[model samples]
Structures are given as structure tokens and as C-alpha cells.
Target chain A: MSRQDAPPIYLDHAATTPVDPEVFATMKPYFTEHYGNPASIHTVGQKAIIAVDEAREQVADFLGCKTGEIIFTSGATESNNFVLKGVLAAAKIQKPHIITSTIEHPCILDTCQHLEKRGVEVTYLPVDKEGVLNTKSVQEAIKENTVLVTIIYANNEIGTIQPIAEIGEIIKKANQERKNKIIFHTDAVQAIQYLDCNVKKLGVDLLSLSGHKFYGPKGVGVLFVKEGTLIEKIQHGGHQEYNKRAGTLNVPGIVGLGKATELTSKNRVADSKKQQKLRDLLINSILKNIPDSHLNGSNKHRLPNNANIRFDKIEGESIMLHLDFEGIAVSTGSACTSGTLEPSHVLLAIGVAKEQAHGSIRFTLGKDTSEADIKKVLEVLPPIVKKLRQMSPLK
Target chain B: MDHFRDPHNMGSIKDPDGVGEVGNPSCGDIMKLYIKVGKNEAGKEKISDISFETMGCAAAIATSSMITDMALGKTLAEAIEITNQNIAEKLDGLPPTKMHCSNLAADALKKAIADYKSKNK
Candidate 1:
């Protein structure tokens, strides 16, 4: 039960994790037996409503917030859009400014870009070589007209954990000193699995998460909007989700999210410890055994289950294909942008050379990863790197 | 895997008649093709030798090897007829997304041939 006993080692948990069986079991009833519109005014509808209310409470309990604070969306992308656009639109301030780090997920960055064209001023703060954001840079970037500050809790490609608490504290102090209520948001989609997600503990007024990233069903995510956080409705529909988002609920997915959050809150401590050991072993062995290979991000401030590595004079796509031939699955970077053949923006942001960025590969461990998986990777990687190097033009 | 592991004609041809390099670093692929021109018994220009050095994915390397194998011993005119599809077919067809690699190989070969022709003229 420690590792998935399979041919292809699933080492891309940062992209998505397989749904837990227990979470699936909890979702089955909502799809079939308890199938009813939560908005209907009947007994079956009431039954569905009870299930939804319970799920809301579960997610709220996991995030340590009130039940009404959690709003379900199609996925994290929509949740992020809602927060960024909704806050700015509702603010109604002239030329409202926003602050975010350069290493944010595309949803945040793209949304910010779109908002900028509409008289919004946005500042993208750069991270250090290790992909860690400087708190002072964020403080300096906050203008008097800055309406919101959104930063990703952990980078998807590099697995760098930004100083979320420190940034939050700075924002809190800035709001008090300037008497400007600049809302703070963190896209915790990558952090929900192994990091502490309590809203109060992180001091984030708005947080975003996707179900699929944490062993839940896809197409469902939650955005934690703190009480009294003024936000306008992005989607117009009947009175569902308090009219903030208007659509019939994905009941099964919501149930799955609730269960996934509950399980992650309970098991993350032990899971992180186990994955950290495997991850360190993988990183150390690859660094020690392979020549001219380097780790991509911070050694200390990174996710427990992630490793981004680069080998000199070798293409990452080649390594991915060779590893695929050996029945081991990995990624060069984010799956969302895999087919584009562009070197990772995160790598470039961290000051990695373009040639080195092309050679970067990401290996993320999960709860099911085992000792045998690590052994297989160690045994398989060197020969593949060697073969690629022998064929490489630079080598 | 076969062509990628043991490419047909790899490495640079020393003191070659012409060289062609295709692809950019941002695309994560760069291919350099070198060729030697010679006169055949039929008094026609033929490619005496062809080799490639590729920094790319499996498909890119495979297509480079395949193009070199197809171009060697062929007349300049015949080599000029080679297309991305030909190189892909020679390798049992690459994925749709990877067809660009075959394009890079064919383009590099044509550039090398053009270089040889212009230099000789």
C-alpha cells in the first residue's frame, strides 16, 4: 500500500493525483441514489441540500473558516478568475492597482493581463533564483491604489513555497497603515495536499484550490472568500452560491472535494514525511550519481513531494520520451503547457539559462510512491541521461 | 526508439562542402546537417556523405537520422525533393505534434544542399 505496484510510476502528482477510493465511494450516492437538485423545493431536493450543506461544513472545517465562506466553482481557474475580476469590478476604484509574483500560475497571470487593459495597473514581482519571493519586494510594490494582492502559495513547476505567511502579515500591516483595504489572495491549489491550509493561519482573505490536485474528482474547486470581503458576482444566474456563482451544483464532485479535503487534513502530516524521504532520496541520488545535473529550486523551502532537476547538454523532452519507453511517467514541466515545446517560464524566472531550462525535468512523489519506485528511477535515469548525452550535439 | 538510440548517420562530417542548421533554442530543438558533394559516374552531382547533429526530442533526432539516411548517395535534385512527410514515413510516422521535427530535418537538408550549390557556382 506504500507505493502503486504498477508499470508506469505516477510521479506527476503536482499535475493531478488519482482519486482516492474512499472519496469515490463517498461520491457515488450523490450521483445515483441521492440524485436531486439542491435548489428544488421537495423532499429529494432537501436530501441533496443536506448532503451539500454537510460538504460545505466539511470544507469549511478543513480550511478553518465559516461554511458560507466556501464557494464551489468548475475548477481552480474559474475560482481564480472570480476573485481577481470580481474584487476589481466590485471595488469600482479608478485605475485600481494589483500586485502578484511573476511565478504565478497562468490563470492568475493571464487574468491580471486582461484586467490591465481595462484601466487596472498591475505589478509583477520577480522571485529569486530559487523561485522564492522577497517579502520586501511585495511591500514595496503595494501602492495606495492597489486593490488586491494575489500570489501563488507554491509554484507548480518548481515546487517553491513562497513566504505566504510573511506576505500576508505585510499586507495586513499595510492595510492598517494605509487605511486601504487591499484584499490578499493565495492560489493554494498546489499547497492543499501537504501544507497547512487554515485561512487564519495563512492570513489569506481569499484562497483557491482544485479538487483534482488533491485526490478528488476533477471539475470542482473551492474559493475561500472571507466574511465581509466585498466581491461582485462574475456569473449571472439564479440564486445559487448566494448569486456569486450561478449554476447547478456538481453534487458528486462537491462530495468528493469535501472528502478529499477531510482526508488530506488528517493524513498530510504523515504523508508529507513519507514523501519527503522519497523525494530527498531521489534528488540526492540523481545529483550524486549523474554528472552536471542540478536541482532546480530551493533546497529547503520546497514542497515535500516535488523535485525539479536539470541535466546539462540534454533535452528534457528526450529524457521524458526515454523514461516513457521504460514505463516510468514524468513531465518536463506543467502538463497544461506540455505540447508547446517552450522552455518553462518558471525556470527562466529563476535565472536558469535557456539551454538549461530546456533540459529541466520535474519528478513529483505522491502518497503511493514506494521504495521500489525510487530504486527503479535511480537505476533507470543514469543510462537514459547517458544515452541522450552521447547523442546530443552539445556533448 | 530504434532510430533515436542508433541513428543512421550521426555526428558532423569533417570538412564538409556545406552545412545547414535549423530550429531555434526556444522550440527546444536545433538540428545541424552537414553534407559532402561529389560527381557520380553519370556525371551528375550526388551527395557523397551526409550526417547530422541534433539537440531535440526523440522525434527530432529520429527525423534527422532518417533524413541523412535518405539523402546520402542521392543526387542533389533528388535530395531536394525530400519533404517532412518523407522523413516521417521513413520512421514509421511521427506523432502529429512531432511532425515539426521532420520539417526541421527536411529544411536543414535543403539548406545544406542550397549552400553546396551556391558555393560551387
Candidate 2:
């Protein structure tokens, strides 16, 4: 029987998509057959270097940037920290002012918040009720000391796609008046499939991507450091990543990320259309079956693969656990804070009531997700919600 | 099904004066224990009955069943010591993660029994 006919349907792609079979096939040879370190000067090492560069070139082509721009790191979290710390060390940016949104991934939001504790000034811009981020508000939040404006390309919890291109332009216009040009950065951990990520076109100076967010292996990510951008070294070890990122290379993971990026570039348009259709199917059925259900983010200005819903008078973890028992995987909000009972900050940022935020669930579709799987989820979920509510205090 | 559905004595307690309520909002599980205790016509205290209402997984429901059965007729002191480890050991051991819920539920029951003892004294 085909694996597609299996019972448990995975709906939590945002948490982590299964490694694509295509990516695995491409990465398999590197672990054993060509295990030499890329940094060594020997011929075997030179061969590994060529393989790494080829993958880098593939990622660069996919991102529409120079091959020299992509710096491999552990994941998006490190990339984000690198960018934030890098600005602090730059010769031009002294006691830098950083601007970020309140609803960014914890890696971005927490990093910026922590930086504030160390005497670095930070302004957290607000989003609209639909979790909508506006460039105008971000522009207004910038100050004379503003050093870097980093925003998430898409929110992992609510799936709201920020206006990154517009914000990029705002930074560009502002740079003309200031001698110290403000660097633009984005945590595109959730935008691998949808965002129009032409670094030159988007006018961004730095970008962060995690392999696990796409259908690749974990523990590997890419940071697009625009050539000549003034960012400091966060880690001081070997001369890896052109002295930008330190430590030994994760060769297999880097290869997988490159293949995954190549696959995304090739199939994003078709895959997004497929996921959008499946997302709507599940969403429409859920709204019809569950009472007091509402979309958490903008219906149109969100990830095509993501459907976040708030079901009043119910708990998200209960729903997730019940769904998990039924062989369907899902999420309450960001995986970063899914352990807590407190409402998601993203939901709260968008003006969702505290009770509604506790009831939210994020269902993210992926490359292999199908219409059949969506229909099966619709069949299994309503009764679980009804049964849980029937026994709950809010009922 | 709302009341622990103990096919043997589900919600059959008469005027359950002793009760317990403990819940975890994050995990979305709540267990409520109902116990009856009063002095007989001859002027001696006895636990007349016990029951429960729990909202959780099948394992949780089963755990609730085991708890009510264990608490039904015991002296307040004896019932108060019935712990999560006891419940798991009784039920052939719950999966590791569910062990926490079992402990929380047992603690709630013991606290209820203690509360009852305090009121009587």
C-alpha cells in the first residue's frame, strides 16, 4: 500500500515539515562517500569545498543573490543572533537603535527584547487587528539612532505575511538622509515557500532561513549576508563562513538545505496553489462545524499553507491532544511557546481576547498535503471539539 | 460519560459532602471527586460512598475510575495517602507523560480528604 494511505495525517508542517525524499537522496552521499572537511587544504578537502560552493550557488540562484552572500549556520536562531550582535560591533553603528515588530518569531522577538536589557534601544512596532504589519508604522517607529530594522517575513503562529518589500523601500528612502545607512534584516523562517525573496529587489541587507522550516533536515540554516554589510562576528572560532560564522560545517545539513531551496524555487507556485486550496477546504468545513469559530489572521494576506482558527470556549492543547490521538498533528501557536497555557503574544498583539487566544490552533499545510487528507481531518475534528467542550467549564 | 462512568457506581453517591477539584489548564484536564461521609445512627463516622467527574483521554478516564474505586470506603487518612505512584502501579503504569496528570489528580483527592478531616475535627 502507498504511504499516503496511512492513518496519521501530519498537519503541523510549520512546526517541522518531513524531510523531502528528494532532499534526502541528494544529501545521502556527503555523509560517508565524501566526508572530508571543506576547510582543509588537501585535495579531498578541496573536493568537499567544491561541493559546498555548488550548494551555495544553488541557494544563491534560488534566492536571487550572490553565492558569497549565503552564510551557513546552525539554524535561524543563530542567524538572527548573528545579525543583531553584528550590528552592535560595526564601526558605524554605536549604541545602535533596533526596530522590530511585536509578533516576530521568538528567535527575533526574544533576541531583540534581550538586547534591550543590555542598554540597546529597541522600538517594537504594533500590528493591526488582523495581525497586519504596515510599513508606514514601521517607518514612523524609526529614530535617528535606528541601526537595523528587522521584521519577520511571515509569522509562524498566525501566518500573517508582513509587508516586507514595502518596509524594505522605507529603509532605502531613509538611508539617503542618514550617513550611517540602516541595515534591513528579515527572519524568513516561515517564508521559504511564498515570499517573493529577491534580496536585491526586496532591498534587504540580511536574511535568515532555517532548513527545518522547509522540508530539510534540522540543525542547519542559511543567513544571507549581503556582501560588504557591516555586521560583527557573533562566534569566534575557525575562519568558517568567511569569518562571519564560526565552528565546523554541518555538511550534510547544508547540502539538504540547498536541495530544499532548489526544490522550493522550482515548485513554489504550484505547491502554494495546491496548499491554498487544501487550506480553504479544511477552514471552510471547520467554520461550518464548530460554533463561534473565526479566522485568526487576514484570510487573504497570510500563508497559503496556514489556517489558524480560534474556537471559543475550548482549549487549544485539548484540541491538539485529541487531534493527536486521532492521528492528526497540529499546533496551538508558535512551537516555541506551545508548552505554556498563557495566550500567544501574537494573538494578543492582534487584539484577540485572552480567552480566544487560548482556544487558537494553527493548521499548516505542506508540499505533500492533499485534498483527501484535509477531508479526513474535517471528518475527525468536529466531534472531538464537541466532546471536549461538553466536558469543559467554558461549555 | 461526564461523571467518571464507573459502570459499578457512577454518580450514585448520596449527598457527597466531601469533594475535590484539581485541574491543569495547559493540558486541559480536570478531575472532580465526590465523596460522602457522615455519622451513622449509632454515632460513628463512615465514608458512605465516592464518585468522580473527569475530562481527559481514555487513559485519564481509566485513571479516574481506578482512583474512585480505591477511595470509596477507606478512612479519610488512608484515602489521603493514595498517591499518583499508587494509581500508576495499580493500572499497570500509565505512559510516562500522563504520569504527571495522575499525580495531580491523586493530590487533589488527598487534599479533599484532608479538608474533610479538618472540617469534622
Candidate 3:
């Protein structure tokens, strides 16, 4: 019965996608007999070391970068911290400044906030009504002391895909005029699988990706450091990840991550089309049934799988619960801070009024989402919204 | 909540004296409670039957189910007094953030019982 209550529909891919079976299958052997410490020079260690090197090569190939540019970390959160800490530590005497956007992940936000306490000035560029930071905003925010600019490639909350190429160009032009050019970074945790995330074309000096965000295992991530980028290492320990990050390699997690990268590269186009259709269906149907609703981002520029809707007269959490009863799984942005009833910061960043922010719902499609699942969602959601609006105290 | 592991009083009730539908749709958690309230010949206001349906997180669903179990066969007045805190305590204390879910069940119960009393009187 409990299993029955666990609805088969899973539409919350942005929170964390399930590991592909193929990736898990590729990673299984390393858990036991094939396991060895990558650091040790012994045959056993060399075996693991060889696997690690091969995984790094695979990861680099997937990202269209050289092997040396990659640094494995716990996840994107750690990678963001590493980049911020590394640059801050190296540029101690310069009274460095950093620029980021209001829509950045908390990893970037909190890290910058921490840096502010430690004497670093941070310039927060604001996004437009659609949650997009224009290149002009970025260019205007850069200052003489600005050492770096960290922005999200795609917003996790509202699914706003930033104009990275344009933003990248603006920063490059800004850097050309300065002696200590500002480094460019983007947290593309949500862009790796869905969007074609090529670091060179994007011209980002540093980028962070959580493996789990792209259907790899949790606790494993990649920090893409462009060659010649000056960044400092925050953690001091055994020189793993080229002395850039410390502690023994998470060989098993790295293997899973590498496998996941390969699988995503292989299945990205086909799987994206599959999820996109479902996303469009959900968006269209919800708008049709719930008339007083609005789409949150530029339809053309958003992720294929992301469909954010604001149903007037209803709250997101209440809608979430109502749909949850109908055996559907969706999100309202940022599962990282789910327990908090506060509306999403990304929604607020995009200039969504607090009322509309409370009413928003994010339906992110994934590899396993089916048409039937979406049909079930459509079947049960409209009535729930109607009923909830009738009960809302705010109304 | 217990329902996640072993849900209690889950079947359809034969008859009901009061029913509770509480949970904020804006918050994405809801519970519907059906109660059978009447005197079993002894003039006691016993909740003769009870069942519930909930839409929310596992914790919320379980809390709703637990509250129904606690209120089944209970006196109507006694059932109305069950606080959200009491329902949460029954679950060995829910996660701090989900405390409102317990309140949802209790609040819905109060509404249902009051509805019942108003209609019968």
C-alpha cells in the first residue's frame, strides 16, 4: 500500500536526477575487488589511478576541454567555494572585488557573502523580469578592483537560460582593458546535460557541475578550470586532484560520474526531445485549464525540460500537496531549501511579485517521465487549484 | 509519520458523524478526515468510524493517518481538542519544518467536527 502511494511519476529532475542504469553498471566493479587507492604507487593503487585518469579524460572530452583543466571535488558547492577561496587567497594584497548575479546558486551567494565578511566587495547584478542578466548589466558592474565574475549558466529555479556567450564577451572586453583582468565563472550544474555546455565557446575561466544534477551519483562533481586561470585551493590536505583539491579520490563516485557523463553525451539529444514534449504539454494544458496563469521565462530560451507556471489565487506549496495526492511529483524550485515555506529567491530575483511567487510551480521533466504520467497530472491538477483557491485565506 | 511505514485506520468508514478537511492548498499539503460520531446506545458521543485521505509529503500523510487513528472511537469533544502539537508528538515529533502539517490535520479536524455540530444542532 505504501508502495502504491509512492506515485510512479517523477518530474523533479532539477532537484537531482536518478543515476542511469548504464552508469551504475559501469561503476559497480570498483566498489570491491577492483578498488584501490589512486594515490599509492603499488599495482593496486596504480589500477585505481589508471581508472581515475581515464575518468578525467572522459569528463574532459565530454566538456570539450583538456584533461588538466578538470578538478574533481565533492560537488558544485565545494567547487564554487574552491574557486572563490583560491582567487581570494592568491590576490590577498589586491583588495579584490567579485561580481555575480542576484539569481546565482546559494553556493555562490553564501560564499560571496562569507567573502564580504572577510573584506571582499561583491557586486550583485540584477536580472530582468524574466530572470536574465544582460551583458550590459555585467559590463556595467565590473570595476577596477573586480577580480572575478560568477554567474549561473541556467537558473535552477525559474529555468532562465542566460546569454552566456554575450556575457562572456562583455567580461572579455572588460578584462582586455585591465592589468589584472577579471576571471569569468559560471555555475552550470543545471546546464551540463540539457544545454550544450562547451567551456571554451562560453569563455568561462571556471565552471562548477554537480554530477547528481545530471543523473550521476551524489557527492561527486567537476570543477572546470580553464588553462592559465589563476584560482586558489581552499582545502589543505593530501595533494589529490593535482594539489588543487585534497583528500583521497572518491574513485567509485568518480567512476559513476564519468559513466554518467558518457551516457548523457550519448543520450542527450534524444532524451531532451522526450522531456521537452512532456514539458510543453504540461505548460500548455495547465495554461488552458487554469486561465489566470502565466509562464515565467522566455519560452524559446528556457531549458527544454523546465516548465514554470504561476496559477493565480493558489500557493505553490498547496498546489504541490494537491498534485502530490494525485500521485504526481513536481517542485516549486530549489529542493535544497524545501522545508522553508518562503517563495523561491530566483522567482523574486526575476521581479515576480511575492504573491505570484507563492503561486508558482516548477514541473521539470526527466528521462523516465511518460505521457501517461503527464496525463495523470492534467487529470487531477485543475480541480485541486480550483478547490484550493476557494479555500485560500488570502483571496 | 506512521502511515509511511504502517498506515492505520485506512479503510472506508461505514458511517460518519463528522468529517474534517484541512490543509492549506497554498502550502501543498492536505488531509480529508471522515468520522463516525454518535451514541452507541449508551448515549456516549463516540467516533464510531474513522478514515482519511491526504495529499502531501510522506510525513504529512502519515500524520493525517495517525490523527485519524488517535481520534477513532474518541468522544467528539475530546477529538476536537487534539492539537497539531499533539498529533506531531504522536509521531515521535515530526521534522521541525513539517510541524505545520500536524497543525493542518488538527485544524482540519476541528473544522470538520464544528461543521458536524453546526449541521446536527
Candidate 4:
């Protein structure tokens, strides 16, 4: 069939999800009818402030936290930066230390790298073969000057869910014996959709999540800061977000995020069950049909919707482009796709060879993904792999 | 893009007169060129057939296919003159990041010609 005649199948949900219609409808009125600065004292502004407060309450309810603890920012990138830099800046010691894993998103890793140049000591703990962090490593890395322990709840590329609650428990136990209590932060951008995010249960002092990853409008996110966790403001400006994040609020995006959070709280169980079934089917079928193909990351502890597979001898960009021609969208860890000279750091940290990392593809299912879509991918992918393998010289 | 979708002159030739392989898997691209050298009507050594086996991205595979098509049935002297710029131009253009792919393609062809000359000498 011609490319124009083929139906487009979207399976790259880990990158971003389309905004839910209900969330969009909830946000519509705030954009036009209730448009006002929340900082103003006029009635129009009060309307905006009420909406923002309601949104904050909704987010707090979803996370099982207090409304005052939730500080909204631009997105998870800002929220991550705020937690890392803010906490370090507020440290009382001459040389503060941080403990984080190697699989965090670039925002967190780059921020840590930048802080290292300015005299902050950072211990980058490595993960196991399945991209799972060892809590023992975290406990070993902490020192008298250690101020924060930030880790990703679920990895972006491999979708391996880390043991955040266990790590949090370890920190809590260690804090009881020290004069300086260590703060635990988690970048839960990918975990908000599938896993439990109760702040009390997870024992996290701070958590960051983005709206765009969970079918909400972009440019809005939340940073849950437990009361009494010392963190100075990163962006200095007028008093906003309890003087933690200083900027005029994005009211519409907040409303959308609130609606999205409410919907997720209601439908998470059913969504998880459905997507897990489809994800397993996709993984099993691909592994069975393709030769020399294997799954990356931990199969048992991964996100319900993510499947990262590597095919021997064939490059992932070629497979991805071939799939694109068939009107299917997926992602790859190959350096060619990322416009960089190195492959995925997450894969590398998990012990995947550089050449093998070049052959990995990521398929992330979403709410709208269907059995038909999975079938279409299964029907098209084997032949593409075969053709590319025939043309490859890696055998 | 068309060449990437339906690559031409793919696969290696059996018992070819010369072979040239370039690139490494560490850099995420490897191209091997196979050439068959024969005499033309003018009694000059010419490339009668050529094919490539490449393991890389769309740009890498597409450039490999394009170079094979450009060098086939050309005199040895003509084939040796195929520069990376000419190969990229023949494929319309390549992204700046993928220009190295075209360079690999041209280098593979030149190496094949050199291999042929060394054997004939």
C-alpha cells in the first residue's frame, strides 16, 4: 500500500500524550472568561485565584499531600532544577553532597553536573543490569555533608521503575541518627500515570511531575515540598507559590493538569490492567517472531506500557524510519535518531553495548492504543527487521 | 527519503574483484562496498557491477545505495573521482550530521578502486 493510504498508529506515548478532552474542556473557560492575574486584588483576579486554588487542591488530593505543599511551576524540568539547586543552595554545611543514580533525565543529570563544577560533591551510583538502583549503594554514598538524595521513579527510555519507597525508608532510618536530616526527592514524571504516588506512603520529602506526560496541557507541573524541608527559591522575583517559585501563574494549564490528575486517580487501576496486557502481548510477539531480539530493562518491574527491544545486526533508526513509512510512530535509542554521537545513557548504564544500544527501539502504549494498533505494528515490524538485517553487514 | 525507503543495489556481490569496508559499529555506521571490475568497449578497466551492505541509519543506508548506483559501469578512473560532495548532491542533500555518511560511502568506493589497482599491479 502507498504511504498516504496507510493509517497512522501512534505508540510513542512516553515522549508525550495528547491532552484529554475532559481536561481541555475544563480549561476552556479559564482562558477567556476567567482571564486575570492571580496576584491582583480585583474580583476578576479573585476568580483566577479561586480556580488556581481549586486546581492546587485537586493535585494535592491526587498526591495525598496538603494544598500548601504543592508548588506549581512551568514543568518537571523547572521543578527538578528547583529541588536540586534550591536544596543545595540552602545547605548549611561548607561542602554539601548529593546522591543520585545515573539513569535520571538530562535535566537532573546536567543540573548535578553543573553543581559539581561549583564545589558540590555528587555521587553517581550505578544501576544493575536491569536498570534498577540498589538501595545499598544509596546508603553507602551518604556522608555527613550529604543534603539530598534525588532519584527518578521511572526511567524515561527503558521504563524501569526504581525502588523509591525502599530508598526513602532507608533515608528515613538514617536521618534519625544524624544532626542534619537528608531530604529525599523523586522525579516521578513517568510514574504518575501508573504507580502509586502518595507522598506519605513513598516517604519522599519532595516529588516532581509534569502535566504533559499524563494527558494534560503542557507548561504546568508540580513540586511537592514537605513542610520544613529547607529549600531556597531558585527563581527570584515577586512573591508567588509561597515565595518558592516566583512568576505569574498559568491558570489554564493548571486547570487542565488538575482535571487530568483527577481523571488518572479515578481510572488508574483499569488503565494499568489494560495496558499491561497489551504491552506483554507486544513484547512476547516481537521476541518470538524476530531472531536475536531481546528486551531491555527489567521485565517484571517495568512500566505497564513500555517495551524496549533490541534486534541484533540491524540499526534502530533504519527500523524506525521503515516503520514511519508504514504510518507507525515509535522511538529509538540510536545515536542517529537523537542527533548525538553517543547512544542512550540509560541503556549504557544498564550494561547494553554501544552497538547493541544503537539497535534498540522503544514502544510506549497509551490510553488510546488498541489491539488493532498492536496488531498493525506486529504485522509490519518483522518484515522491516528482516529487510534491514539482510542489508546489514553486522552478522 | 525515497532511496532510504526502497534502497537500490543492496546486498554484497559474490566473488567480486575488489571489496572496501569502512566505519565501525561503535559509531553506529558500517558500510562495505563490493565491486566487479571488467574491460569496457574502449579496452579500459571499468566497474561492471557494484553493491553495498550497510548497517546504519536511513542516511547511511541511502548514501551507500546511491554510491553503488553512481559508480556502477563507470571506468575505474571515473569511479575514483566520486567525492563525498558529489554523492550527497546526487541524493539531493544530506543533513549536516549525516554528511559523514556520504563521506563513508565515497571512501568505500575509492578504497575498492585502490584494492583493484593493487591486485592488478
Model 3 chain A weakest lDDT span, ten residues long: A386-395
Name the TM-score of candidate 1.
0.94
Ranked by DockQ, the better of candidates 2 and 3 is 2
Measured with C-alpha atoms, the lDDT of residue A214 in candidate 1 is: 93
Real A-B contacts recovered, model 1: 0.53
Off by over 4 Å in 1: A1-6, A334-341, B1-6, B88-99, B117-121
A31-99 per-residue lDDT for model 2 (tens digits)? 998888999899878777888898899889988999889999999999999898888778364577999
Give the Å shift of residue A161 in candidate 2: 0.5
A19-63 per-residue lDDT for model 4 (tens digits): 999999999999899999999999999999999999999999999
Return the lDDT, model 4, position B7: 89
lDDT of 1 by residue, A239-352 (tens): 889777899999999999999999998899999999999999999999999999999999999999999999988788788877877777898862213667667889989998
lDDT of 3 by residue, A199-296 (tens): 88898889899989888899999999988888878888998887888999999899889988888899999988988888899899988888788999
- Look at candidate 3 and tell me the lDDT of residue A33: 69
- Ordered by TM-score, highest first, the candidates read 4, 1, 2, 3
The candidates' DockQ values read 0.48, 0.21, 0.11, 0.68
Worst 10 residues of 3 chain B by lDDT: B1-10
Regions of model 2 farther than 4 Å from truth: A1-7, A91-94, A334-339, B1-69, B80-121
Which candidate gets the maximum DockQ versus the true structure?
Answer: 4
What TM-score, computed on C-alpha atoms, does each candidate reach?
0.94, 0.86, 0.80, 0.97
